[model samples]
Target: MTRSRTAGGGGPVALTPSERAERGKAARSSVRRSEQARFEPGPDRPDPVAILLEQEAARVPELVPIRRGRMLESPFRFYRGAAAVMAHDLGTAPHTGLEVQLCGDAHLLNFGLFASPERSLVFDVNDFDETHPGPFEWDVKRLAASLAAAGRDNGFDAAERTAVVLDAVSAYRLRMQGFSGMRVLDVWYARDDSADLRAMAAQGGGAMLARADKVFAKARSRDHLRAFSKLTHRVGGRLRIAPDPPLVVPLTELLDGGGPTDLDTGLRRLVDTYAQSLAPELRALVQRFRVVDMARKVVGVGSVGTRCWIFLLLGRDDSDPLLLQAKEAGPSVLAPYTAPSAYANQGQRVVAGQRLMQAAGDIFLGWERLTGLDGRERDFYVRQLLDWKGSATTEGMAPQGMRLLARVCGRSLARAHARSGDPIAIASYLGSADTFDRAIADFAESYADQNERDFAALADAARTGRVTTAEG
Candidate 1:
């Protein structure tokens, strides 16, 4: 695709596929693709403990204990919340300098099933709290390492973990190669439909496929109504959020002379602010619903200490409810190493990045800036709370099941990268050889070792009372 260069008064020539591929191959002179295949903690390695403490300094004090509690469960759990630590390490490692909008914390658990705008279930990256443009290899390394850590936690043999990571990398290589040859629009529109996945599972016919069936079934049941029924109750002839300490604290409880009247006024203001971020049509649809209650909800492992609120809105009647989550957005973990975001608000940066990377996104997705009751201003992105969301559990997955999931995750990541980066360059760099794949597997094993040491140090800190942790 050639384009006119108005400033130069001439048309800029577009490079052929062969030229693009050659350009990628030439990049090997600066940093060999195989060079990134290993992991080592050189002399200047940053202290992982110090990194964790620095991140903790900015989070809610009360929720820190809960975050610590969840992270302390296992090495894999600790890895999930240590994206900053990994970012620091990636900065010290070899890099290809091919930038793509990365899922900065692209761990195994981060990829999951969620509903598309069309209400069809799809598989994609469901989290974007730490997204930024960075070296493409960074995401691949993070994912491979996560597989190893999770495998170790699940008592899978080292051989099993190695095989899984290799399969994932190979899948990514092949998919990118395929994407490189496709029309740009075709790559942009590709998505993993849940119906297609189910059909594949049915054809495969194994214990692994059976497990996938269960995950899909669970996702189908987790819609807005399910969340509303489970989290709210009738109080004095009106629906109010149930008070669950720490995990689910109603906003009204945070104020003096707390009552429904005070809560409604404050929450309505927040709703108005959030509505301004949405498109005019979405705003109109949102305005039709009346805000009933809001609650501080403790969410994911990495996000526990961050402020997250769940809003319940009544539409047509008491039975008609819509749930939305307004999640706080901070600077991405990758920000310290990569270029800063152009968007002034971090929430807007998140929303923009998610839209650019995903094939589809939540219709209600938007960003807002609001001053909290504490007089602190925070950026938050809002979306539907539960839209057929489900994630695969590693605990009971068979070896075959893990491998199949690995391939799906790999393909999803490739598609995401192709949408935002040069598919030809990435595919050319990977080539048809298994060199990159083997190298990533090697790095995954080595990094998994490093993660265990970091996890052990954190566990010791908790046991010695250096850090406080509350049991879940």
Candidate 2:
């Protein structure tokens, strides 16, 4: 495969299968590169925190209610704060050659439970819209920092917070080591079902078992039928979305701004592209359904300004409905660090990365280019956005619950990395859990401080009217 370089002053390069194999082999051989890079904090370069804030400030006018709603939520506030710091640190950090497909924002909150293709609930890294190949340490650092931040939110003392983060890092290290010992097929087959997780928690002989059971219950409660029941309402034999401010609103209202009638036309065209992306069996299954209600919905903090749509499709019966979400795609946060995607469309990058990371993704996953109301061409990917998805509550989890959650995240992350990484070499580099745990613990504390500084800056900007908060 030949790809044109969009960054740097480089020309097109041909990457043959053999050359690709060689690159993977080289990456495997150099897996311990992260260990070689001393983990000292780097001198600040251009503050990515400030840069991100400036970007957000530009979008604030367009993202009034949704962004304000997210900022008002404490956990969401902390997440935004942490993201600013991570982006800052990453902008300044020295290179560790060990790179893999990263969940650019791999915070503890991002890991969750979703249904696998087999209709069994499995714990996994649930979001990958920002996926890109980059230094593996970035993901580890972000995850560790999130643990500390979460602990702080739960009112844990510094010592307790350290212990929680250390335990999580230890689990991540040990799981990676375990994967190194597995055969390729075994690693590929490896999955963490609710039963397996509960059993592991029981074996840990702590307060983890009860917490694991609670997590299992939450995961099980998020099936397709349950999700549909919660989001849809029946009105005279028709299925319709219950309108909610910011999060959900009718399509007619969204198109009423006199922005463009083509918005609806674009949506219809995108749905056809989505249908074509599905596997034959799934496509056939979906073809039986008729589109009933559609809405424009806003979701997530960082993704507030992007275009997102939800469609309610009803089968022969009103009770049989499926909900799908289509989200716009832009350049990845990791784009600066890794090679630019060969595909011109960012949505294609997202779809490809999801397929690579998930064993069985929504068959309807796909992308298309559409001209928006502003006459800007945008890329979008469509999927069964929330069929059976749920996450452990991080707000007030007991210390033991945090530990169990950490292990689940660790195991899931290992499985994700193992899919595209050289697990054997990665395990070898990790060695024992001790050093890895300590390193991440140190990074987490330092990064948390960075987050605080950035949060204060944001507050200052809001006060000074450089960036207007909803309160302003």
Candidate 3:
């Protein structure tokens, strides 16, 4: 397949619009869109359980069982935590090799409502732990497969599941085509408005509309104040984080000889390093707050075992609390297959990819490298713990609502790709027909079947004591 941009040999020569379009069309000769539409397990697929265990080697030993238990919940849950498994399989799949910064784990649940820097709710990809540059189809496949898994989890019949997957692929294809004809700045500026999503949900009638309204309302309340009320309490006249065993515990409680002094000192150093990563203006804003209490917060299914810490800071007083999350960042699951990142730190890779793909990002987003209390150095990206963030649970969505969510996610993915990759080339590759769309639907159903088997394998592991699990 032809590369989207000129290959670097000496100096680069900019290709004309026609040259770019022609190159995109030529890609179809080597990588036919129809060929990529199916999924079949290769004969030499890696053992899913083995791959998962390898990942656990670098994670918190105590939390590894928790991550496993979360994955054991259902097929959909398994899919969410098994990004490395899918990356291994995607390597064997046919592709055009059109690269884009992927939300490597672009599952439906990863798309959510969060306030922009302007305080307006915008729907976009929220997680970047697995962000990397790779074949654009990998992200699409992940999203489509997620719909199928989630559809089954929600008890939708096969027909309803098929419809949802198809709708999402069609939205992605059509949106890419629209982006192809737009100005570069226009494509960069494209964003999913929460109001527009609400209007779309309204078409599903009163019940669906009410659900959407409730979700949005809940998202609006996920600010620092809301977090403070639930996570903090007055301890000897000082506001300190409340203990929530297993999931939310003060850092001092987890470490050997760990106490307030040690916790505060380490956190203060982390915040100082993180502030230097930010833009000078933002660094100035951060300097106003002093670190108060930091805690180990077990987050999502995929992130439960990682080193995730939430640092509490007060801007002026206890009334002006700010919470930020310092999440460990590692090599992208796709990194093994794709080229190595140009950035030195994996956290910087995540930050750079997020900046390139999102229309806008958290004002507090930054990265740092530090040695933990265990004395092992790791990279981490930091951002606001809750900036009016809201996400819809798969358990509650109706088929119609799932379709709407799929469309928005598809459109958001397109927007993200258009910003960093060649939209014209991708759109030209997708074409105006249903060939690519139908093919993804086929792949999604097939992969969904594979996912069930993988899920069953993990369940067996848990039952046989091959893997440890705890109540999620």
Candidate lDDT (C-alpha), each? 0.86, 0.68, 0.87
Better of 1 and 3 by lDDT: 3
Query: What would the TM-scores of all predictions be?
Result: 0.95, 0.86, 0.96
The candidate 2 region of ten consecutive residues with least summed lDDT is 30-39
Q: For residues 268-343, what per-residue lDDT tens digits would candidate 1 score against the true structure? A: 6777778888889999999989888888899989888988889999999998899999888999988988887888
On TM-score, the leading prediction is: 3
TM-score of 3: 0.96
Candidate 2, residue 250: the lDDT equals 71
In candidate 3, list every pair of residues with a backbone clash: none
lDDT of 2 by residue, 375-459 (tens): 6788888888675677877776778778777777766777777777655545555665376667678777766666666566656
Return the candidate ranking by lDDT, descending. Answer: 3, 1, 2
lDDT for 205 in candidate 3 is 88
lDDT of 3 by residue, 16-62 (tens): 66787776777788678887766778778888999899988999989
A best-first ranking of the candidates according to their TM-score comes to 3, 1, 2
Per-residue lDDT of 314 in model 1: 93
Please give the RMSD of candidate 3 to the true structure.
2.1
As for model 1, its CA RMSD to the true structure in angstroms is: 2.4
